[model samples]
Target: MPRYARSERQALADLFQTLGPDAPTLNDGWTTRDLAAHLVLRERRPDAAGGIALPPLRGYAERVRLRIAARPWPSLVDQVRRPPAWSPVSNPLTDELANTMEFFVHHEDVRRGRPDWLPRDLPAGLHRALWKRATALARVMLRRFPADVLIQAPEYGELSAGRGGEPVRVVGPPGELALFLTGRQRAARVQVDGPALLADRLRAARLGI
Candidate 1:
């Protein structure tokens, strides 16, 4: 099987290096440098990683992130490309589970941020992998949403999500769907079918893992 995580890691690192520190990313307030710094801290700083999940710890995490972001851009990108082996999320055993989607999403965040961007043709297996995770993530992020969310990736599979209401079918390939539901609705390419008002509302609603 192809190693999606590492490929995405390298791809994102290369893009960050190519774009330089000031380039815009789909991440609302982040630039290429900010994104690279986050990736480095995510794997290298265990103590601060929890801040990503816990509201109170966010202050500490931001402090560390800012400190890291101030480093030379090349160094930050290198750290993202080659995480130390001892890091909890970088070792082979946990890498796929920890970083596959993490890197994939962030990679697209940079890719789609550019005006001339085009979606890449992802591998079939990787599409399946992304769709499987997207299903699980949808259950979490859209659990309270006001519509019955149907995620459709034509060649892969389909699944339902959200609290039931007017059924909303979100159509796209797996990778795009993953991006859409993961708080990148603006950057993702997808078709929403349902009541127009409800569909519009759905698009405006919060999504992502």
Candidate 2:
């Protein structure tokens, strides 16, 4: 697949400028400036990036992110627009693997944060790539879920996960399915097939990215 990360990076930079630094984002309590600063720190600061997942470092991570956010908004967003050459995560070699979903999800985070936003008309190749990644991620994120989950992505393939309970089938485009599985169920436009209560529970259940 073509490098989607670069395009998304540029798109988010543009959006940040368009909406202004005070714009809201789907990430609770984070403004556009906050999101931009987090992106900058993720690629540039190795010591704090682990806070995204590891609870032990979360405090440090937030402190570092806040410190970056305290800088001038234009400079921070520009840093997000242009990743440093030495950035381990944003450089050409790792950008595709590490930043595609990162940027895409965050792009949607900013998009869906506002009212009347619609899904992007993504390329087939990008959808398939997202499907491949979501499938692998589902194996892990859904492993402990209460119900047995089936993810159906049209023109791609399907992934069956979750521990054991009732079987709930999730039907959507690959990108939507990825969003649903990654803690964005409230925003993901997908059809859930199976019992009504089970479906509600599935959508409400905690999902890790």
Candidate 3:
């Protein structure tokens, strides 16, 4: 099997180096430097990683992350590219399960953040991997959505999400579906087929990890 996590990590790091520290990313207020620092903290600093998902720990996490972000750009990108063997999420046992979608999404966060960017031709294996995760993630993130949601990646598979109601069908490639489910709805090139108002609402909704 291909090590998508490793490949995506390296690609993202190279993009960081090419774009420099100040380049914009799909992460609203975060720059490329900020994203690199976040990746470093996520892998190396278990203590601060909690802040990424937990509200109460966020302040301290943000402090540490900001400090890390201030390091030299090349150093930050290097840290992102080479995960330490001792790190919790990036170690041999966990790296694939943990970072595949994480790195893929963040890679696109930078790639599609630019106006002139175009989608890449992803490998079929990676597409299948992404579809598996994207389905699981969609179920979680869309659990509260007011309508029944059916997500489809024609070459892979499909699944239903959201609270019970009128059905909404979302169709796209697995990678684009991943982006759509992860709150980058505007950036994802997916098709939503449902009630006009509901489809529009789905696009505008805050959906993510």
Candidate 4:
């Protein structure tokens, strides 16, 4: 199988080097340097990574991330480029399952963050991979949404999410659907169909892991 996790990791690292430290990303206030630090911290310091999803641990995680972010730019990007072989998340055995959606999303974060951005022509195989990941992600991220949610990647697959209510259908390619479900709704080019108010709410909802 193709190693998308490894490829995306390397591509993101190259993009960081090309854009330099100050470039923006779709991740709210995070710049390229900040994103690089987050990646490095996630892979290198698993102890601090938990704070990403737990409010109680976030302060410590942020502190550690800031320190990592403060490293010289080349050093920080290098860390992002080369994850530790023994890290639980990025080791060869687990890297694909863990980092495919991660690096893909963050790669688009930086790509779509720019004013002159255009979508890439992704390979069909990668599209299949992303569709698989996106379906699983939508199941988790949209589980508690107010309306019944149907996510479709026309050429790949579809899946349902949300609790239950009036039905809403989101139609787009897998990668864009992934972006929408991950809180980049404004930046993702996808179609939403349902009651106006409910659909609008779905778009505005805070999403992602």
lDDT of model number 2: 0.88
- Ranked candidates, highest lDDT first: 3, 4, 1, 2
lDDT of 3 by residue, 80-171 (tens): 99999999899999999898999999999999889999999999999998998898899899999999999999979989989979999999
Global fold similarity of model 3 (TM-score) = 0.98
Q: For residues 1-209, could you state the per-residue lDDT of candidate 2 as single tens digits? A: 48788888899999998998899998889999989989988999999999988999999999999999999978988899999877889877888888887888889889999998998999987897788888988898889877888999878999799897889999999888878878888999899998889899888877864
Which regions of candidate 3 fall more than 4 Å away from where they truly are?
Answer: none
Task: Give residue 145's error in model 4 in angstroms.
Answer: 1.3
lDDT of candidate model 1 versus the reference? 0.89
Question: Candidate 4: lDDT of 92?
Answer: 87
Predicted structure 4: lDDT = 0.92
- For candidate 1, the 10 contiguous residues with the lowest summed lDDT are 200-209
Cα lDDT of model 4 by residue, 81-116, tens digit? 989999999998999989988999999999999999
Q: lDDT score, residue 172, model 4? A: 95
Give the TM-score of each candidate. Answer: 0.96, 0.96, 0.98, 0.98
How much lDDT does each candidate structure score?
0.89, 0.88, 0.93, 0.92
Worst 10 residues of 2 by lDDT: 200-209
Candidate 1 structure quality by residue, lDDT tens digits, 1-209: 68999999999989988889999999899999888888888899999989988999999999999999999988888899998889999898899888888999999999988899998999988888888888888889888888898989998888888899789999999899889888888788999999999888878877763
Clashes of 4: 0
User: What would the TM-score be for candidate 4 when compared with the true structure?
Assistant: 0.98
